[model samples]
Target: DFFIEFSRQGPCILSRSILQLLYLPLFNKVFGTLNFADVLKDAAKNFIFPPVLMPKSTLLLNPQAKEYVDTFLTHCVRPFGNLVQLCGHNRARQRDKLAHLLEDFATLQDEGEWKTIEEKPPPSSPGRDSNLDLPVLSSLAQHDKRVSQLRHGGGGLDVDSYHRTGEAQCQRAERVDAYLHNLSLKSDSPRPHLACFGTWILYHTLRVMIMYLLSGFELELYSNHEYHYIFWYLYEFLYGWLVSALSRADSFLTEQEAMAEIHKGRGTKKNKSKKKKTRPYGREITIYQALQNICGGFYKVHIM
Candidate 1:
C-alpha cells in the first residue's frame, strides 16, 4: 500500500487504460469483491494537492525528485521498453546461463553434451570462428594503440606492437587508459552513439583511480621517496583524464541542446518558454580544471 502510494505520488507513471489492460485482471482476482480501478482512481484523488494547501514541488522523502525521475525515465524505462520491443524473447540473452542449459544440448562425447558439430580446435591454436564471430573486445595491443592515439592528440600511434616474445614490450596500460582510447574512434562513428555513457564510465574509472591513490597517502602506504612519482602521476594522468572526460561530456551536451533548438525551431514550441538550464558536466569541467591547475602548481613546487 505504501509502495503504491509512493509510486503514485512519486516522480513517475503509466496511463490508466494501458494499466487496466495489463494489471487490472490480476488485481481484480486479488481484490475479489472490491473494484480495483475505482480504488486506484480514489487513491489518486489527492495525488496532486491543491496549490492553496501545498505547492506542487513539495518533496516527500527524496529532495532531488526531478533528477531521480529524469534518470529513471531516460536510463531505465526507455531503454527497457525499446529492448523488449526490438528483441522479444531473444535466446542470445541466455548465453550467460550456458552452464545450466548444457543438459538441454544433445550429448556428443562422454565428457560433455554440446551444440556445435565441429571438432574442437587445439587449445594452443584456438580458431577465431569457434565463438561465432560475435563482437570481440579491444585487445591489450589495441588498448596500447588507442592510448597512444589519445596521448599523441589523435595522430598516428607510434607505440610498439605487442608480440608473444622478448620481455613482452607492450606493457598493459591501466583500464581507464584503455577505455579513453576508444572515445576518439567512436566519436566519428554513427551506429554506437554512446559518447555520454563513455564519458560517464571514464569519470567513474578516473574517480576510482584518484580515490585509491589518495587513500594510500592517508594510510601512509608510500615511502617519502615515492611521493615524487605519485604526485607526478596525479598531475599528469588522473586530473588530466578527468578534465578531458568532463570537456567531452560538456561538448556533447552542447551539441544535443543545439539539435534540440533546431527541432524547436521546426515548429515544436511546447517547451519554448522554459529557460535553458546549465548541465552538471559544465560545472564539473570547471571544478576539475581548477584542481588540475592546483596539481600542476604543486608538481612544479616539488621540482623546486
Candidate 2:
C-alpha cells in the first residue's frame, strides 16, 4: 500500500521513483516476467486507491524520503530474504522426509518389472521370517495404513503424498478461478488482466519445482543410475508444465488486448497493424520453451 501511494505521487521524485524501479525488478524476479503493468491497472480501474497522477514539476519532495527507503527495505526486502531462506529450509526438509518413501516406491516398481519380465511371482526378502503367515499379516496391516493415510490426507508413500499435494494444488487453483470470476462480475473489471495474478502464482509454483530439482545437483544428491529418472522427472514435470502455464497466460493476455481494442473502437487497419507489432509475453514464453527443450535434450541423452 505504501508503494502504491508513493507510485501515485509522481513518476519523478527528484530522480526515478525508488519504489517504481524496485517493484519492476522485484516483480520480474518473482513472476519471471515484466508484464505486471496489467496489475497496476487494477488499482486504477477497480477504484482501489486510484492513482492521482501529479505532474513532476509541482510534486513536493518528501522530507522523510530517507526514512521511507529504510522502511521499504525493512518491510519489503527483509521479508523477501526471509522467504528465500524458508524455501531453502523446506527443500532440505522435503528431501529428508521423502527420501525413504521414494526408495521404497522405486523398489516396489522394480519388483513389479521383474515379475513381468520373469513370468513369475516376485521373491520374498532375503531376511524374511520363515513363517509365511507373518508376512501376509504384515502386508495387510501396511495396506490398511496406506488406506487410512489416503483417507485422512496423511503421508504414506511418496506417490500418495504427491497425489494429496496435487489435489490441494488443484483446489487452490479452483478457489482462485472462482475469486477472479466473482471479482470481475462484482466490480466490472477486466478479468483476464486480473487473471494474470493467477498466472503469477503458477510461475512461483514452477519456480519452486525448478529449485527442488536444481538442489539435487548442487548437493550431489542423485546417484549415477538415478540420474536417468531425475532428468526424466525434470523434463516431464517441471519445464513442460512451465511452458504450458506460460502459453496459457500469454493467450489470455492476447485475448484481453484484442477485446480491449474492440471496446475502444480501435478496429481499424492502422490499429491492426500496430497490434501485429506487439507480442504479449513473447520473450518470457520463448525463454520457457528454450528451457523445456534443454530439459528434453538432457532427458534423451540420459535415457540413451
Candidate 3:
C-alpha cells in the first residue's frame, strides 16, 4: 500500500519541488541566518496541521517512495528488454539481450514442427497475388499501431512486425542493405522518388538508429496504453538519432578512408591511422531511463 501511494504522489510533488531546488538562492541568499531550530519547528507544524491539497498535487511522504518508483523502469527492462541496438559490422558488442533472444526465436521458428506456408493465388485473379504481398501484423494492438505509423511515417520501419525465417540480426542487416540500394541512388531520375544518403554507410547507420527506436525502444518501454509523451518525445528521439547518425557517418567515411566516392562532391580519401575523432553515443543512451521519471509514479500520490 505504501509503495502504491508513493508511486502515486511522488512524481506530482517531486516535479515541483525539484524545480524549487533550482531557485533556492531566492530564499537563502537574501537571509543571513541558517536557523536550524526554526526550520525543524516549521516542519513539525506543517505535518501536524497539513494544508488542503493543491488543485492537482498531493502531499508527499516523509519516508518517500521516490526511490522505488524511480527505479521501476530498470526493473521492467531486465525481463522484457534492455534497450540493445543492432549493428551489422560488430554484432556481439552492439546487439542487446532482447535482440539476441528474438533472433534465436526466429532461428528456432525456421526449424519448427509447425510450418505456415503462404497460399498461392488463383491464376485468374491478379489482385489476389497483390493482396498476398500486403503486410500483415499480429492482432496485438501494439503491432497494429506500429504498422499504421510505419505506413504513414518514413525511414522504412515496421517495428512490431515479424521477419522471415533467419537470424533477426542478419534480417535487419539485409533490410538496411535493401533500403540503401533502393533509396540511396546518386542521381534522381524520372523514376520513383527515394530518400538518398550521402554515403552507403550513412544510410546503414540511419537504419540502425531507426531499428533501435523500433526494436530497442519497444524492448525498454511499453506503449500499449495511451500517450507516451512523458516517456519519450518524438522530436527529441529523432533529433538524437540524427546526431548519432551523423557521428557514425563521419567515422565510417573518414576513418575507413576508401577512395570510392560517395558523391560527386563528397571526399573518399583513406586514412591508415585515423584517430577516434569524437566520443560516439551508444544506442542505449538516447533511450535509457526515458520512462523512469514518469511510469510508475504516474499514480503514486493520491489527493487526501
Q: Using TM-score, give the best candidate's number.
A: 2
What is the Cα-based lDDT of residue 231 in candidate 1?
Answer: 63
* Model 3 lDDT, full chain set: 0.28
lDDT of 2: 0.39
CA lDDT scores, all candidates in order: 0.36, 0.39, 0.28
Model 3, 264: alpha-carbon shift in Å? Answer: 19
lDDT of 2 by residue, 151-269 (tens): 11233123343334333334433433343344444443324223333343344345544554565776676566555444554565556666666665556556655655676775555
In model 3, the clashing pairs are 7-300, 8-299, 8-300, 8-301, 9-300, 9-301, 257-270
lDDT of 3 by residue, 1-304 (tens): 1222332243454553443344232342112354332332242222211111112212212123223212321222221221211111122233343233333332222221111112122111111111111121121112323341322123223332332221233433243223323332332311111111112222223233334344333344434322232123223233333444444434433432332222322565655675564423344334433433333244132111
- Who is ahead in TM-score, 1 or 2? 2
For model 1, what is the error of residue 83's alpha carbon versus the real structure, in angstroms, after optimal superposition? Answer: 26
* Ranking of all predicted structures according to TM-score, beginning with the best and ending with the worst: 2, 1, 3
Q: Lowest-scoring 10 consecutive residues by lDDT in candidate 3?
A: 125-134
Worst 10 residues of 2 by lDDT: 110-119
Q: Regarding TM-score, does 2 or 3 come out ahead?
A: 2
Model 1 whole-model lDDT (C-alpha atoms)? 0.36
